[model samples]
Target: MTTSALSAPPLHSSAHDDNVPNGEDQAQRAAELAALHRAADAGEEAAAWVRQLAGRQGEEEHGRLLERVAEAIVKASSREIIPGSDGLLTEELRYTLAADVVLGASHTTGTLPELHPGERMPLIAVCSIAATLPSCVLGDLVREVEVLAAEMEAATDAGRAAELPAAG
Candidate 1:
């Protein structure tokens, strides 16, 4: 009788069909995830392009656009996330501000206009979160944003190169 430790049966049998190749499902899933990531990345680029165009128009216009976008995000998540339970600006509201409120003069405006109930919560939340960010973290965040911008730029260049006709 031959003794071999390598002959041990697998601890669990695969639920998939026997003829189906291994890693095919995982490869498909990976491709799907990559597609989703690419779509999201393209969306971010589109938003930044819009922001840049707005900024080119004027500071006031850009600021207003930022405020509107932030407002939309906050309003969308109001009932489920913000709830207005702890006054108007809750922690959740602050987090939304962090992600959505990049451009604007709302931070400079110290006094907030009186808002009825849920109104202006987004603006208030934005200014509050902007004011709360530590200087060091803000610096780091700016650096990271720059890095991401460079990466996106490189990716765009690579894609354009791929699309161009080969020289004779």
Candidate 2:
């Protein structure tokens, strides 16, 4: 799977520069905010996709998938991180973040956003979960979900085919 790099918006720096113009700083801040909004939107879409995939499975199968996800999370989290890497997030943190999103999205009520109380997680919520994660992690998470979805679909189709009477 191709890992697409996601550019996160720059965090606001506390230091004030006397030499820089105020207007330019304001414009830059606005741009950064826009980038963050875009990232949040992307994260929400990814969550929805995973939820859909989970919805296709039976209860037992869904439970199995969740188990697999848990196992994956544990494995991913146990890996050692390289010292002084350029990545803003470590592999463990990324996996944990992705797992949180995936688990929340895969909840039974997570597919529908219109319900009051039980509503699917809002974009803001998803953004909060993904705020620190880089785009590559989201991309990887989506790719893995897609693979699982495909496998589930194929298995379902095969079962159906087996149930049908053989063509005379």
| Clashes found in each candidate (C-alpha, N, C closer than 3 A) | 0, 0
lDDT agreement of model 1 with the native: 0.39
Candidate 1 lDDT over 1-168, as tens digits, reads: 875765654456776747443578657546544433433343344334333333443446444555454343323222222211322434554554454344334455542222223323333333342323222123333343234334443543443344356789
Ten residues in sequence with the least summed lDDT for candidate 1: 76-85
Find the candidate with the highest TM-score and give its number: 2
Candidate 2 overall lDDT versus native:
0.39
Instruction: State the lDDT of candidate 2 residue by residue for 11-102, as single tens digits.
Output: 45335756443777777556544443444444434444334434444554453453443333232222211123342455544544452443
Summed over model 2, clashes come to 0
